[model samples]
Target: MKDQIRSFILPGGNIAEIDTREVKACLQALMKREILIAGICAGVDVLDHAGILCDVKSTHFSDADLVTDKNVITARANAYVDFAVEVAKKLNLFASEADLQETINFWKHYQRVQ
Candidate 1:
């Protein structure tokens, strides 16, 4: 489901709907300073679980509050969109215009799913 959106939103950006099971390998790529991302919902959970959001302030859907896992980015929503703009704004700070263009193209491609 999410990959469909990722494919459309990132056209030529090498968008990947990496499975949580492979997050360890994914994290290696993410750790590189050049990698920019916008993780949401389970995606956010994966990053938090991996100890990357510890100090970033992201969000999740669980009623239970999160613990200080890898310092965790305290998110503001249970749903993906809640942190979307925030994440995008952050990504824009580093990504190129072409990257954003590809990202939007990917989203436009997937918008039909809803």
Candidate 2:
């Protein structure tokens, strides 16, 4: 199960869901695997509740769009693009630096790809 997962993404939604035993257990399992875990907006609170944000630098709905520390990536409520970009970068999805920059330019900067 854990071995098959490359990353775990928790999207912003009902914060109360985090308190459930099933959610907690799943988070704990992923934490032990040390896989990439991303929490967007209110989702950051979920990660915090899971005790995975300890000693980790994270920004929750802050001025900074995205913050990536170790295997964790966090982002503000309105920073969906930044969050996706950081996760793609962490996963090495781009073939080259130019590809990454192009992606950023097109998505983040809203520039036309040339």
Candidate 3:
């Protein structure tokens, strides 16, 4: 993991310093489309650091231990959805009907590559 971190940093990839221990940075990065974001189990913790979550609704419990700012809607259970919206809010990436349409279009195109 540190090696991966080093590579991204060596390139100075405009990456933000996010606490990966809880998934905050990862989610924020994805919301902004700064980095292609995906994770499982612990990796999702990094997104939590950026104030995001995963398929939280499916789980009644979590092991994450991180936080960003003081206030905002947080993941009650399903973090992926919450995080996506949060990312949109952060980048001003999604808002209104047009914003939703744009997000859907972007995701549809994005998933094709993945």
Residue 75: error of model 2 in Å? 0.6
- The residue-by-residue lDDT of candidate 3 on 6-107, one tens digit each, is 101111122344343434543454455434343333434344444444433211143442222322223333355445655455445655868777776776
Task: Rank the candidate models, highest lDDT first.
Answer: 2, 1, 3
The lDDT of each candidate is: 0.43, 0.84, 0.40
lDDT of 2 by residue, 47-89 (tens): 8888878877889534677888888899988889888988998
User: Can you give the lDDT of residue 41 in candidate 3?
Assistant: 31
Between candidates 1 and 3, name the one with more favorable lDDT: 1
| TM per candidate | 0.38, 0.84, 0.26
lDDT of 1 by residue, 34-96 (tens): 244445445555565655654454444344332222313334234333245334645354277
Residue range with the least summed lDDT across 10 consecutive positions in model 1: 6-15
Clash counts per candidate, in order, are 17, 0, 21
By TM-score rank, best first, the candidates go 2, 1, 3
- Model 1 residue 8 CA deviation (Å) reads 14
Top of the candidates by TM-score: 2
Deviating ranges (above 4 Å) for candidate 1: 1-21, 60-82, 93-114
